[model samples]
Target: MTDLTDRVKQAAAAAEADSPPPVTDLAVTDTALHWLQSRQSYFTDALPRHVDQAHFMSVALSIMPALVKCTHESVHTAFLACARFGLEPDGRQAAVIPYGDKATFQPMYQGYIELMYRHPRVDSVHFGWVRERDQWDYTPTEPSPRDFFHKPRVDLTEDERGPVILAYAFAWIDGKRSQVIILNRAQAEQIRNKYSGAYKKAERNAKRDSAWHTDFDAMWAKSAIRRLVKVVPTSHELAELLKADDDADDTTTAPPVIRGTVIRNDDQADNADNRTTWPAAAEPGSGATADTDGGEQA
Candidate 1:
């Protein structure tokens, strides 16, 4: 027998020795493998890709009591029950990606973050440096302990569906997450467009979670930040005033800005997806103040 088989046998024997006669021991076999595979496919394929990972598994497992109660239900009926599961407070707070070509794997990350903590969106992930010593200090004495200090080992969920994942991490896992989502390009694009600059999801093979790689980080650091950049700290009047005060004597270049578009014609700008070009300076009161570049007319 293989070492794994031997290990299973020894483990089973130990369990039997420690437990009361009434308790059952798990047996490993081909039949067990087949059952596991079938259960896994049902949970995974039943849901729409739009569903985040947490809700997907939760919905799938909720049917177990039904499966247990109605053992006679056809396997097809049992499988369909997962898709039909309804969540109250519809669309509560999904970290939805815009439907687009680029966001194919966004939901996986959304699910991953949701699985770890109930954050509202990917933009809200709090990432910062942690000292190596601090990390070591938190290590537990045993592996896979229930304590948070142990840090979770990414693994298959109890429902047999795949573990929640992030596109960042999926790179290290050989694009499995992308492969899963790419099955529906429409769904993937929807996510990609919304989170266009949200993640550094590269076309290259994914090798890890988080954009630790130079190219990976570069994408988010530049593009994502442009998206993340909130409205310029103050309105144009305040911004211009602050600029004048700070550079009372200096004549250096201006601060970088993500957005500075200001359209005076509310009606035209509101209806148009187009942006009006601004000159360094427009004729005074032309309702064109592009010249006062404290950022933009906006």
Candidate 2:
């Protein structure tokens, strides 16, 4: 057999023979290192290191399960971002929700946009967040001319003349038509409440932190975009990679990471400040919208 194949078999045998009781202590074999190296093209940022030896072990344990339920390609793509975002690995997908938290596992804004356009039928996807103007506004980005025919529309509606924190827009298309949906501060909170177990730890901190209180617009936008991809005509592969998110941490159904295992300034720590905080706008002097190439958007 080829050297690489032989190395992988040897590593698997070692893992099976001495599988440590602490999942986090499992080694990152040469095979996994090779896998990570081979998938570099799929990522944009440098992948974050494991928070500790335990975190590395958890990642090692995750590899086999990811490969089994998620196809090799799917697990590879999911890990590309998971490593970057320091997300906990689920079966086919990865979790953004901190261990034992109740809010859904939403991706970082950049990851959210990337997964959207990764949809084969998706011509393009753009994101906007609430601004200081007492209305929801987004960066005014134009899709490529080829996509102008079915550009997704983003806008807000009025209820009683007061700022409608809740807004709906046509954010996605199935290559056939568009889908209008609602994304608002209320919905995000509702989601958090629905997955209350996951937020129990964060909710206590949110009461003290202005960061969480002030960033609802960006948070709502991400929540909306994540929901949009699942309901639309994305690739089956992309969908499978994200499917585990539907009821993340709501029950014992999820794969476990090191729960109650705290590391100071831990990369996996769920602090609001350490989390994905959205900037007020994507660019200065640009309209309320942020344009990104499936990466960071305003």
Candidate 3:
């Protein structure tokens, strides 16, 4: 009986040693690196050749410090979404924002322009904010053709340009301008109240960290382009991205579940039935300016 018990103890110890370490045992960066490495095939198939493994890893690590405070599953989902969009999360083209303990992928206005330009038919895309002091003109019918014009007051500083009254986005297809979508301040506020859960939460908590609070004009530009895409031709990828943003807009919806290699606590036991349905792609509606140096030209 004593010999048999000893053998059982030895077997159990060996089995425990063979099992993978719990997620908490590793540094957040190490765990993220491991997760990204495991998805090597996925990235290779999804990204262009110029985005090599080293470059991909560097981008992932660049933002891990900020992501460290977020839930592991949320981090994984954010990275997955970032990979799906093929945008770099350098806070310009795209960003991974942390809302409470949840991390959400946000595609910047520049990112939208980047994706729009990818379509073969798309020639140029432009978004601008109209200020009270700016010269603006729009004619639905004149000279046998519709025309729109906006010239920001260059003499005044950005703040001195006065409050923004409108936001507009238009695209060129086959070198011809498409229908322009313009949103007035009231209209833009309605859209924000309707589709921006993050903004609402920030308002409630009085948090100034959200881009919606910090970069209102940029978010307004994004809203204008989002509406413009409805009438314009869009790529399947862009459509999917828009849908993701819509999903994220609904505050009641849960964040997407990480698909594979579930990470759990050291004390937790493996359970085959722990899987949950993956939610729709989630996006946060906060990003930088619509135009920047080196951005795609109209």
Candidate 4:
């Protein structure tokens, strides 16, 4: 009888150990929704008028599990960026990527074009990668009226098109191509090696998870667009968007604080005027249609 009792006790203990944890607590999604709902006004005020709160909440909830794995503060900062930029965390326009316990908000190249169109001055924006097999030409002239042309080879498969040799971004203003910027493969690599801390870390670990590795073409185009934004006239919001991306690239520094819709960098507190401010919501039906010249790879 003593032996049987001991055996039964051991069996019960083993079963308990093998069983899953009880579902007594609220799920990550539920908790995140509750938290977001509690601060609904804060997020709603930051979002552009075109993006409804209900839709944003649904998208946020879809990614809540991943966001919950990150530190609470980091999650808040990431969502703050999402709301302010009016980009969804749906992995298209923007994404909240996890770096160990911290999460960073990364706006996709599409997101850049989206915000560019929000500028009343911008008529259209386009970014494309030049393949080694593609016919490309650019002739820069004095003062104004530069010539540019590109014809990607249709006979070749995407891989057969060969490695990307160049990336370019162009913008139309007043119904004409007013600004153009191009980056060669070498220059794009230099920018990645210099500014992408994530790329460096991935190199050390022999991992190819960084965007620089997974989406080289997109990053290449983005680099060109980033350069174009500097020379072209853009809104304060567009400039801030670039700054936000720059901050994400520099992982060595502490994350910026989101103070009432402003992304204030603690290290740059002396330059308070350069802080990011929430842009006014775009007018309904004024958003520009996305350019279909090049589709961003998933």
Q: Say which candidate scores most in lDDT.
A: 4
**Per-residue CA lDDT of candidate 3, range 215-237, in tens?**
77777778887888886688787
For model 3, the local distance difference test gives 0.65
- lDDT of each structure? 0.27, 0.41, 0.65, 0.70
- For model 2, the run of ten residues with the poorest summed lDDT: 260-269
User: What ranges in model 4 sit over 4 Å off?
Assistant: 1-38, 142-146, 204-209, 258-298
TM-score of 2: 0.38
C-alpha RMSD by candidate, in order = 27.2, 20.6, 17.0, 14.5
Score every model by TM-score: 0.18, 0.38, 0.68, 0.71
Give the worst 10-residue stretch by lDDT in candidate 1.
96-105
Model 3: CA > 4 A from native: 1-45, 48-56, 143-146, 204-210, 257-298
TM-score of 1: 0.18
Model 1, runs deviating above 4 Å: 1-28, 39-41, 50-121, 127-129, 132-298
Candidates ranked, most accurate by TM-score first: 4, 3, 2, 1
Question: Cα miss at 286, model 4 (Å)?
Answer: 34
Give the C-alpha miss distance for residue 271 in model 3, angstroms: 8.1
